[model samples]
Target: MLSNTTPSGRDVLLPMFFIGLMFFILGFVTWLNGSLIPFLKIVCELSNFQALWVAFAFYIAYTVMALPSAAILARTGYKRGMTIALGVMAMGALLFIPAARTGLYPIFLIALFTLASGMTLMQTAINPYIVCIGPRESAALRISIMGLFNKGAGIVVPLVFTALILSGMEHVSEASLGALDAAAREAMRNDLSQRLVFPYAVMAGALLLFMGLIHVSSLREPVLDAADAPADAAPRQGLLQHPQLVLGAITLFGYVGVEVIAGDTIALYGHQLGVAHYGVLTSYTMGFMVLGYALGVLLIPRWLSQRAALAWSAGSGLLFALGVALGSSGESTWSQALLGWAGVPAVPDTVLCLALLGLSNALVWPAVWPLALEGLGKHTAAGSALLIMAISGGALLPMLYGHLADVSGPQRAYWVLLPWYALILFYALAGSRLRRWSVA
Candidate 1:
């Protein structure tokens, strides 16, 4: 049941506004990795495998800090936890100054870890709060609405990074670096790395301001009671006994992995395919995500339930993943047909298929959260933490893709996403419904 004190209709607007802002913050910081990957590859003189540790260090923090976030939210409440998270994130943003000054890859990874730790806190607090606030049936719908705010920022973060950092900077490939002497290469790297100092400074200040704003806001802590519990709720021995939530976490693991690949690696692959505007490639994926969220907002619960939407998303992911793995590397009619007349440059068929994964992935996170926690009752907090921890998929899978790219090539590396989508397709079809580990 929905909490009595939680807002409804117009009353819901204020709380949603604050949560939506946090989601925007999440998207902005997270999606920047796509641009940063190619940029840092230049600055740090790293291989594809080494560069993807950018994602690894960032997302691994969720697994490390999610349970701690639950404990902190238990005491400080959601509003205070979010405030603390922003302050922590601001500190991490300020850390970028030194990282830029020295141009040390390890320091940059440390900064990213700090930022993700804070983001983990924010996500742990907000996801359950959003789910438990409204009618249970519409929880997926509510999350999809939040997805608009989250992915809406994804659509712009890379473009902003490009305009601020990549523009006017001399582009260098690992291939081109061989021509430059050591001193000259070091000088160029220092100059390129220094560009980050100003933007991260600005980001730190914004995070501090947002922290203060959240501290002063009137957001309510979510009140989860027995009303939210399902009748078949199991004993609290361990959350592992619950199959729906566990399977959902696994589903998220795969979902976020492929989703990260789609959103973050498109630029690298585009650059490899000789696309000129590769830096802004993440925007294509995010744009498709925004469109998918809009469709979810309109159609969910009204015309389609969350489970059905997940099925469709998974199927689309399978088709698109195959396209990415096997489709033409040459420029295709897809981008021209879809975005050409809009004055947008056309990308290769393979890159377009990779971008389409964002559409297939848009709804999985929102739909999985509600379905996973459905019967948890008193254990919902722990369940949410577990789901949040599963974001390590984003860390691990991309590293795998990067390694595969190095050994074989970036194009064939997309084959890694096939099994991931297949796992999610399994969950949407059958796994989300299981209560115990049995065949029931």
Candidate 2:
């Protein structure tokens, strides 16, 4: 709902570049939870159900705070909204210091929630801001470039955590886990907690500094003349009427669920499957994500349409899930290299499955957004906020995944994606056809 006061210019790329950098940071910070879930679960001695609250607290903030974010944008406009969001994010990062010091699981979840609330606001401002900065036809490519930065951070943050947390110590056996004498365990816990102190402190300082930089930057506001506004102002209509848009939202929701499941769950899932070190899969999965985005940046609109891209992506997901599940259940060499290890391969095969999942995920998000908001002019921002609310799937679906992991084990829990993927495939093939229904 934020409006800009300045004219669009030829050099929009620089500002978009900086914006992409901030998004990269956001993605880095956001996806690090994938690593933290398993790490903190071990350090905090959590049950599968309890540990997954890491995602629940973080992503549910979007459902809670997105409307408020829309309200803030309407008031402060985009530039000031971003500044406020960065400042709040800095405060959230600082909370991690104390949360780490206490080694209390709930406090860490609270800190993550606080942090995610800030991201919710930032995402609300950022995604549309990127779109309005350029021509709509090329939006996916630009967003894909920005996504490269985002998923690129997802690759890096886990590597950093691995070096700092996992690799630095000896691999603790399940037999020895949570069995330390009280004083030793407490000391180990405190030491482990303090590791977060410096990283988060540095992040807080960076966010504050970024806030100042954005305040001083030469970013231009979008110049929307009256001619560009929506053609219609009808107040109440069914989203079902806008089937493509509805389908787009559904696609986005399902895409986020599977992507989070693939990324965040990989570490825990790997551990359960007897992969001794799961940190390595974090970077590998994100590498596939980056590759997918890079491919999208190249192929979309030029060689392929967004709808076509989404369909292929969904199909890849279905195939990859089937390969992983079937391979795990059977004992073929392909299954060993692709799903498990030894003569059976664990890390490599699981990584391959996750990587393939990432590839399938790459196009769904970038393509879905623009297609969803295609014709809704004034309602565009509201519709965007609604889709942003749907990102709450990042929170809820993962909990369901964690519960499934708890009940039937990680590999079996992957059955969760079947329904999610089916919905998306339906949207891509049929839901996009709803554009014919809109008369306005």
Candidate 3:
């Protein structure tokens, strides 16, 4: 049985490499929203709520486009859909050039929507591809490898944006702006805004170039089929009956919601604690998450099973969130140590909480997929799209948290993540079971 169950390791590597490249782009774009939030607020003069629409615009694209992407994949196959996603990302990046020139936040959001819509296409295509590329026992391991590229990008995105934006902001302090005449201030804003031009232009060029590479690449196009057709058939029909898929969608929804909240809200949390330079809080939070991802690369399927890793992570996240809530309530020293150690320049405690949240978040996506897609052969593509659509939780939940923050304060609003982590814990337990409802 062991001999018969061996993985086709070599056959899966090259395709996985290209798939990992797409995941890298996903992480880079998603995590860069951290920088975009503050950058847009300064450049476009947006309120906190308005700036957060950066996340809303980008993640909501998944909800709007997932079904459409699935349809395209159903018709066109994975390789072509990936190529189209790349092309669309290029278009989205190009829109930034003009939006930057005019200092128009709404146009920037439109550009984000285009970019996210493209990612919606890419995610819808690639997730199932990762699962299908290997034996069931090692599917999570392969996806974890895919995630190393994804999280590796997360690690770098903020540093890149910091190099781009922080230095520019140094030129526009209160004193500098105060000294400038009205016209000069306007000129300064325009000049600072234009800094976005070159970065986005380069991103557009890379995206377009990747599109060409994908167009000519030899990646296989996996397709959805009836469950009984072949051992490797994509489960098209029994998907409706699959308990794991249903529960996994809920799990993904909760994971993205909390993950977004942890990363996106921490900067504001730092500000509430009277921490200056809250602008960079998001980057530090990603560092925490990347640390966890690094561990995932080293340990998954070696010293840890994905389910075991997820359960442990989720439990730790719940504990960390509790610590954050307590620290925010006036226990500043503990919170300071938590946040500061992660290199966040603000109230160190808040940064620490956010970083610890990253450890909890680490195994979520990689763990959730294999459990969800365990037996989904023909239905893997559609099921994965449903799971992708659930990512709209990131778009909607943060907006809800924003409203709560406005009314209650950023720290108080963290109460929401308690239940979010609870749901994640549920999935790690019985929710991951493949046939929770079946008579079999």
Candidate 4:
């Protein structure tokens, strides 16, 4: 549990704004993978499974380095820890320059891993810091406010990045490349690869600027006290004794896996569904997420508890998945109506359901963080690291989805999301309430 002594609204206003900026940065860099997947597939000539390594390399860093990130935060505190994380991300961004120059897929993967390592550290520091700064009950609201910035960046980055590097990419498929001579193919790949250099250099510069700002800012470090320890538990029990934390970690894993599938895979799904302007369609998925986060910020802790919000979000996900699977075969009047309303000529029902998944996913993270970390007290940092590690779902599950897409069709591969959402719904309804471990 967090301290009861809530700071005045004015005291935290600036820090919260800065923290939101960090979330924005996190979203901007992280969600670029959506566009990068198809971009790299074209530039590097990758198969479906090979292109999905973009997500695997990016998200697996959380599993690999989250505990180390916790250790780094323990030593440096949140203020300095965030600064270090930003500096590390800047370095990772700089690596893109050479990776783009070489056009090597492995080097690009390395850069993504390095960048995600920094994001893992940044998340490990900021999530708990946000919860500790304010009343615990309102943690979801604060996180939702930050998420607006986060998903807002998600909405923008793909559009801007695709415009910059992937204009006319729909025409650059394997069939077209095969029609070209060897030198022409190399020239095309090299041209596509070079487009990434200037944008990433600008990213490197922006990250360094934010690093300097965070270093000089006076963000307070949270102090854990003896009161945070469980009253009935032994003096030094391990985290495994806490059933809620353990279950919550699994819940988070499922949530992230499904969320990544919804957001990152939308463009690819659109492509498979034969949507011509799939990049533009993908942005709508994130736009719906931003709207949902805005709603969360308004309603959480005021009209709805975080747990209730999570339950509703999970239920919505289940419903959406059912709709996607059952309604995808042929378009109904509703799909046509929706497309007409949006002034688009046609959209497959599956694509619309995938976009609406943004609404289902928007509240899960904010809700899950508070539920998972609640009552961990002194173990909060470690518990947070564990939850962050579960973000490996984003890495592994997408690859699984890709493989399934190759085996079956892309539309049917979404069956994989149904089971993950069922698990999250279980967590929202019961698993989050199973807090058997004492936190005195």
Clashes of each: 0, 6, 15, 3
Which model, 1 or 4, shows the larger TM-score? 1
Best by TM-score: 1
Top-scoring candidate (lDDT):
1
Using Cα atoms with residue i matched to residue i, what is each candidate's TM-score against the true structure?
A: 0.96, 0.90, 0.88, 0.94
Give me the runs in candidate 3 sitting further than 4 Å from their true place. Answer: 1-7, 168-185, 223-240, 271-279, 328-347, 434-440
lDDT of residue 295 for candidate 2: 95
lDDT of 4 by residue, 1-440 (tens): 33456577765787788899999999999889887887788788887788899999999999999888987877777789899999999989999999999999999999999999999999998887787777789999999999999999998998798788878777877678879999999999898899999999999999999999988877766655564422222332567777778888898888888888888888776765667766666577788899899999999999999888988898899989887776754563655776677765466887788878899999999998888887786677788888899999999999998898888877778888888888888888888887675657
lDDT of each: 0.89, 0.77, 0.77, 0.84
Candidate 2, superposed: residue stretches over 4 Å from native = 1-9, 225-241, 329-348, 436-440
Give one digit per residue, the lDDT tens place, for model 1 in 140-213: 88899999999999989998999999897545677777689999888888988999999999999999999999
Give the alpha carbon lDDT tens digit for every residue of 1-440 in model 3: 11233436655777888998999998888888876776676666655677789889999999999878988876677789899999999999999999999998889999999999999999987887777666666666777777778777877876777787666464444446668788987887788889889999999999999899999988766533354112223454556688888888888888898899888777556655645565566766676777777788788788988888889888998998887766644445764555558654435664577667977897798888888877765566677778899899899888887778778877777777888788888888888885758665
**Which residue pairs in model 1 clash with each other?**
none
**Model 2: clashing residue pairs?**
340-345, 340-346, 341-344, 341-345, 341-346, 342-345
lDDT of 2 by residue, 1-440 (tens): 22454324545766687789788879988888888888787778877778889988988898899878887877777778888989988988999998998998888988888888888888887887777666677778878998999999988998888887677644663445568788888787777778888888999999999999989988765544343332223353644467677777767777787888888878876765556567656776787889999999999889988888878888889988776655543233453554454343345454467657888888888878887877766666666677788888888889998898789877777888888877778877878667766567
Error of 1 at 64 (Å): 0.4
TM-score of 3: 0.88
RMSD to true structure for each model, in Å: 2.3, 3.8, 3.8, 3.0
